[model samples]
Target chain A: MNLWLLAAAVLLVAAFGPALCVAAVAAPERRLIAQNLATVVGALAFLLMAQGYGRSPYRDAALVLAVLGPAGTLVYARFLGVLPSSRTVLYGAAIGVPAVVGPVCAAVGPGREMVKVLVIGALLVAGGTVTSVKGDRHG
Target chain B: MVSTVIVIALVLVGGAATAAVFNRDPTRQALVLSFLGLSLALLFMAVQAPDVALSQLAVGSAVTPLMILLAVRKVKRESTDQDGDESESP
Candidate 1:
């Protein structure tokens, strides 16, 4: 198996699975936090999947997810009034994003595609920051 | 290798979908529904359909959950309003 696919599989099992389990059974606050974590993890997985398959177009889904994940959390906060701050997700993005995006960006090299990957990485970090900050204010 | 990723996605999607259905509260269920949306998008990507995955991420991850939450809130408000009216009338 390719390293990218192996990483994607590991991410799905290590991060996304636990996030899903937390979202399934935890209280509303915890569940929302888990949901937020899922988005970041899922986005990273998509990035890895795109690289694994050698398909540039597949990265768009990760881009869309980076933008949507925070917005979705805000929606839940508005309706449920339970926007607990998730430091784990914030820290995860801050560190995990570059860890994943850097390798992918290096693989793609200097180009418009590289720029796109950088932008998506920035978006993921920004989204994680916004959600965590907003949750602090609301919670 | 590809099949391994696909199988993982499939299992996650199934678990999320089942969780969404089993959760009795609309609000919590909405959360599971969004999770389900995300996993399904992953499944689509694993199967080599990025376009479908993109749309699914847009619609499933956010929009559907937002709609369900709004509907639940509206129904809850109306029920409370009716209860208030009955209490005042009696």
Candidate 2:
């Protein structure tokens, strides 16, 4: 019922979902299991955020980040021929699920805390973008 | 509570940076980056922003490592010559 809780829930989902997708694609023999486990923990945190925040703007923003970030990355990878065209389906799922979740949260209740969460989500996405393209010459 | 979370987030960020610089091997560097992603995810949670953290964990920790590993494998494959015929054929 409370807005903050809904905001938190959205944040958690947006954060963890991509991690799961990544883990699924990662090398099996390497430390993928550990990464998956960690991602699961993060996903649980998002579920909590959804429960607490309910449906709100915060959730909506998270949904955007969740969908866009990975989709964008996948698109770029695809263009470069890193990922096969068939894998785009997974990208769709990654974006679609969160897109649905955001609207559900917003319809239930929109609150101020939602805005704060959205802002933070935006900043994180921006930071992530910078990190991905920036200094790491190793890439 | 927010302040404490922020502090923890900073510490995690620092840890990530430290790990990246200290590790020499590219594979090890990739692993450290995963740790960085995990830590950053916690930092996101600390800030009461779960969505960002989750995404970071996914891409930074999971996807990036996979890509790096793939690249490493490709490099390794290229370096090793499997066919003995190459030396004899010429």
| Cα lDDT for residue B18, candidate 2 | 78
Question: Mind giving the per-residue lDDT tens digits that candidate 2 earns over B1-90?
Answer: 345435645665675667567766666566556656766765675566766765775687557856776787677677665454576687
Q: What is the DockQ for all candidates, taken in turn?
A: 0.91, 0.09
Worst 10 residues of 2 chain B by lDDT: B1-10
Best by TM-score: 1
Model 2, span A33-73: residue lDDT tens: 32323333333234334445443333433443444444433
What tens-digit string does per-residue lDDT give for candidate 1 at A12-111?
9999999999999999989988999999999999999999999998999998898899988888887777678778988999999999999999999999
Clashing pairs in 1: none
Candidate 1 segments exceeding 4 Å error:
A134-136
Give me the displacement of residue A42 in model 1, in angstroms.
0.8
Structural similarity of chain A in candidate 2, as TM-score: 0.32
- How well does candidate 2 score on lDDT at residue A79? 26
- The CA root-mean-square deviation of candidate 2, after full C-alpha superposition on the true structure, stands at 10.7
